[model samples]
Target: MDKLRDFLKSWPGRILLILCLSPLALLGIESYFHSGVDPNQIAQVGDASVSLNEYQSAVNNRRSEILENLEDASLLNEDVLHEQVLRGLVDRALLEQQAKKLGMTVSDDTINRLLREEAIFKDENGNFSNDLFATFLRQRGMTKDQLFAEFRNQLSLDQLNASIVGTAIYPMKAINQLIDLQLESRKVWLHRFNWQDYQQQVTVNDADVKAYYEANKKSLKSPAMVDLAYIELTPEMIKVNEVTQQEIDAQYQSFKQELGLSDDRQISQILLTGSDAKARADAIKARLDKGESFAALAKAESDDPSGESGGAIGQFNPAVFGGDAAAVEQALSGLKVNQASKPVKTQFGYQIFMVTSEGSSQVPSLASVRDEMVKRTKAYKQQTLFADKVTAINDLAADGFGIEDIASQENVPLKRIKNYQQDNNTSALSQPAVIKQAFDEFVIQDQSVTTAIDTGKSTVWVQPSRYRPAKTLSLTEATVKITQVLKQQKASALALKAAKDMAAKIKTEADINKQGISFQALGDTNRQSPLLSDKERSLAFSQPAPKNGVAAMASQTEMGATLIVGDAIKTQQQSQLSAIEKAQTAAIIRDNLGQDQLQDYLEYLRVIHKVEVNDANMASAQGR
Candidate 1:
């Protein structure tokens, strides 16, 4: 019994010691078992415990950080929130995996040093301040120990990342090739032919026209379309109770009071501190005193950012000027025109004040604003009428009234479109919504009356006049296009020959410069320039000798220059050299052309790994 009492007495002291050392003991235990713990596991990898509450807290902090960084709060949406959270979790999981694979570790000393150096945790003296650190952690909803753990995990992952990707260097040959391709430039002259110039070339004979019509029977067919007359409803269309003259006068009085003319100021200032403020201010004052122009003086000397505009602050309601109700009343009390006051200090720093003008706070007469009021009243009435009419039309349509019957009953005009198809693109019925609704199988199959379809700012009613099916192009229709193509080819050949003849006329370097026929110095540009077609760019950089010095000829297209390199230019060109090298390069090119190769690589990696997404949880987190 004596021993038991002794033990009970010691137990209290032992409990106090345990409580004092609990946090450190827990941290030590965590470090010892860290290797066996999988950070990626939401509920601890091995025997460690990652509480759901802890993960949620971290997610919320991350979300808050993102929201704080955005310039516009309205742009935040469910998709953006979901994407950010998922990305953050994925990154965390990836880092955890990487850290474990590399046997990476971070110590408490490292995290402490980082915290001390972090600007967010520093004091005015530029040293680590515990108070600041605590405040920051509190604001972010994180504890010091939790932050340190995250930092440690991050550091280990960073080391692993460096091992896998940081030290890998690209081959010099590859870099050089990329740079050379980027810098390459092509030389050519352009010749343009406008379609308008060839309008006279297009002629239609009666037989030809008939043949064309026959061949393009599908195009000749009219589209199915219907004209719509419907009423629109809007707030402006509704009538409201009339506002009386007395009410108008009251509104105007309120406006005048809100303007605060008696308290309004148009004062100028001379900054007496910082970077020649006093000198500038004095110069401005001298100008103002000399009557050299208040605007000019303000522009030259006033420190107000907008002083250039004659120190104008623009008209504002008193509430917006920091002179709220009380300040407005105080400033207005017994104020006189052109009166100046001693410098006053406010939240926006010191300022001198002057009452440029003063007037009684009285509303304008109703006669002065009657026209505006009348316009508003009429608009309201129209809106109400329009809304009622639209509702009537919708009701009629719902009750199986055809557009023709509705138009007749409404006493409105009826229009018609003939032979319309879903793919028909006539300007008359080219509205996307109209096209979609008109072509819907349900609408066409039942010949059902459709609800009014909104075409942007207006609504329309549509009915099919005719429907056409797909058909093959006829020889007669193709002939004219083929002939036009052949003619263009001939013209192009002539233009090229003329260009070549002009180039051949140049002999000496002096002549080349004198005539300003400079060979375009190649810069690093790849084959992507719309300025150069693929064939032209390829020819410009191709190898092998033709009978002539030119590898091929390059000419200008309607858009830009085209190049056709001669054997001479080909000999000087540098890209993939010899036949063997060219063949190897072509293989690499083929590899790049395989569009799905990268996607397939990613899919393979995904299949080899385990990935589980708690979509419902994610959606809930995003407020979706």
Candidate 2:
């Protein structure tokens, strides 16, 4: 118990815990209505389960991101997104389980140094700020122990991934050949057959337009759409209640009390567990009294993983150690630096602690964390209000009331959307979750409000109004479009024939000039050149070296067609590559190979772990 508190309070304990709280990658979201370890699991992979809140959170996250960039959120089908997000979570669970089975761990020294280096926990003077760290965790509803677990698990997962990727074959001979291809360049020339030059000469009559429209009528159908009515609850729509000065003062006092900020102690321990723990602890105390080194004794005698690190448990506090903390604190109260405590009974076993170090009182004045206190106070109030509102809305929903009636009762605005298509991702209320629910067969047939659907910042209730099936347009409506399409096709065909004829006549660059054909002198370029299209780059560099002067080949392009003439095929020696270039090229190859290897390993793990997806839960998603 003492050892874990010591570990948790140390800078390294929750390294990834804070980072996993990526604005993108959620780590225990404060979605009280959804994010708790609820029974609403979407998928079960072995013993690990992914909750519905997790899936909702992922959807909301993705939807909001698309909305932020002014892109259509409806572009992705919510059902598909649901599958993708759930699959990812399940895969993560599998990797973590596998890593645990293999007994993988992040070394204490490595994690600790990383945490201490984290800028979020650092003070103005660059020292680890326990106050700031605690505040951050409090906001996120996380305890230090949770942070430790998160960091350990995340690191272990990364380690497993890296180890598998490391197993990728080098295949240096093939790699060198690929590298040679990448470094190869070519001097080329293009012979053009412009579509515009042929379009003016080709005439299309009314009969042609009618025939083309008749054949392509199915492709010109109008979009299918649905009408919707909904009431949404976004964070901005909810107001935060005020926190009083008295509340701030009370919170300040509580922080100091809970953290034991008066005097912070750092300790190391030698633990003796099992039946004869007390007796063994006494024996070690006697050896310590004889002037043997505490660290050396702990390393040789302790029954804990920390034993490898000379039993250095790091910063100690009561919040982490819990009930056993009372005895440990009392034992440490009388001990000075380098002084050892007598055998103390803890949850783990009997531990003899030595005060390795101590820090000055961490007690902060109300003025010193004032801004953070106000922020924390308001956030707490806001969450309470949000949860209350959600509950109230939920109750209103269950009483057989529609979205309009509920909105009126709750004083939230009701909204109606017209022509809501599955692909209409750009509308104000076009959240993928909402769109998905609006289009659901159950909701469409039932014509009743669905349960609460959580978006990134909002909770939604949707009811379908009407459905509009797709219809084919009349020939008159499709004539203009059909004519344009038919014209481009004929023009392109003519251009390709012209280009092929040009290529057949001109075997060399000099012959191209002799034929009075216009072309672009595309200078030396490699496989990855920005000046050439992907196809153009491959065509330019891949042609056989000219038997006489240059080689010409014809191919179709977007605009028309092109006769490609390769003048010279150039190669750069691998020895001439700069150190950075070589490193970059090697990184590309390794990254590609590593990803494939990692994916193969993950597939193997999936089979071994036996993943079972709850399709009903993933599909229904009837929110709490």
Candidate 3:
């Protein structure tokens, strides 16, 4: 399932799935072109122009992805999304031009290889199926050539980026310095001065708060609120009759066939990689032919992480391995029980496998899987009823039925919420789809009934009854909040002053306990995560062995201030940078450098090609 989801999120996934979020690898979009007539251009990049239709397609794809991921569609700011989309498209065009100039190309073989490796287009046996691939294209109204072209362009961009990043290297000296700070740890004596302790030292009169309120009155505006009357439709509200025995029997058979109840296999194997993997695999196979124990040799010589378990890779549904599934299945297909196969080449390298067991796939009797099936069928029937009920309720609303009137006709209770503000996100009406409809300009201005809003699991229809514009709050309404704010500020200031005084005492070697401040020992903590606040942690690391070895430092926390006396400090050794860490650090440095280079190249393209953005058209496209 994860593999399928990942495939749906990739370049091909975006093309096949409706949730395409980015236009970074916009390959075959040129296929959307109309008959050789002049098209309205949105932007010009050198000699190439972005058609308005192309930009809209990209924007809509990205918008759909966003709405699917977020709960509240109203949270999407059209202006911001439009700006990002246009910028991304412009950058994509620039990179494409640069790729052409550099003569970088992606071959047809690479595109074919990538598609074959895609998990979603594969059968249950992990083998690529042309039928599944064609189905995906047909569903999205695309052709094979169109998607393949997009893949080629995407691969070219990836190669270009890789070439730029490959040349970047981080100096060992800088890396060592970073390792020291990153791994350093400290043990300390800490003291916290609570702000609540200083509450008695401060006094705030009504006059101060009133004066502060008067000066900030214009800025202290109340959020606009609305009153709503809505209909809530859920699957649980519908009653479902019994599912027929014929329907149950048919569904059970379908499930069994879909789940491949005719075949099953239990396999165990050893995987080996590296330049000598083939030779090593051949050697392993030779040992097996000579009757060497498979598990014993696997435990001794295999490189796979599962080698520790005597190479028990476990049973899989064969169809789960998309890339090299076929080669593996083919090798095992001819092997008898307890028989080992010769070394087989796969994407993960050479592997020697043993078929531990084989049998017909198991199918449970109807009695064994019936209870669960009955519950599922009931829910399915209920959902169908719910959908019909919602449509009827919506029809009533469209025919000038008020929420209460609709509720009476449908025999469902109506819910009304008054003075609802958007910021009260905890409210039921604050649900994404409902909030989007409730606050819609047309819904509020024309008092129109919103289209059925699906909140993923439920459906809601909201109509605004009363709307209130945001305005300055009255003194009576804001007085209590202002008083609390003033009190907190006064307490914090007094606490900060007291903390500074205590810090001075600690530096002078005075007993903190005597001054009524209890101290606790914090042992061996890195600045990245400490018992103290971030500021205090940073201050502890910065203090220079404390003057005369007194070993003390001071910093502030959210509640008040803190003083710490370092008991011991442990610095990470440069020798601790393992080979794996070195490679990881180098990769991080290379990636950052690659991004910087890409940004600079894009800027250079903009200057040379004289890129022009059409703000008017962009605004129109965003439906501003």
Q: Write the per-residue lDDT of candidate 2 for residues 124-198, one digit (tens) a residue.
A: 797998998898789878877676666666678667877876666666566667777887877777766778789
Q: What is the lDDT of residue 406 in candidate 3?
A: 75
Return the candidate ranking by lDDT, descending.
2, 3, 1
TM-score-wise, the better of 2 and 3 is 3
TM-score of each: 0.38, 0.52, 0.64
Number of clashes in model 1? 41
Positional deviation of residue 225's Cα in model 3 after best superposition, in angstroms: 1.9
Better of 1 and 3 by TM-score: 3
Error of 2 at 147 (Å): 2.9
Pick out the ten consecutive residues of candidate 2 with the lowest summed lDDT.
26-35
Clashing pairs in 2: 74-425
Candidate order by TM-score, highest to lowest?
A: 3, 2, 1
Whole-model lDDT, model 1: 0.48
RMSD of each: 19.4, 18.9, 18.0
Q: Residues 1-624, candidate 3, lDDT per residue (tens digit)?
A: 787788977765654442233453433223243323225778877767777887888778777768788875655666577677777777767777788788999888877887898898889999999999899889868798877766666667666767765666678778767777778876677777777777777777889889879988997778777898888888887877789765565566566687777435677788889999999999889989999988888899888877888787667455555656555655765577779988988877888888777767654656678887787677767777887898887787778777777778788878888887855556776665576567777679978777687766577887886788788888878888787777777887777776667666664334545667577867677878746666887877776555444466665567766777764467867547797887688678767887787777778889888788777777678653
Which TM-score value belongs to model 1?
A: 0.38
**TM-score of the candidate numbered 2?**
0.52
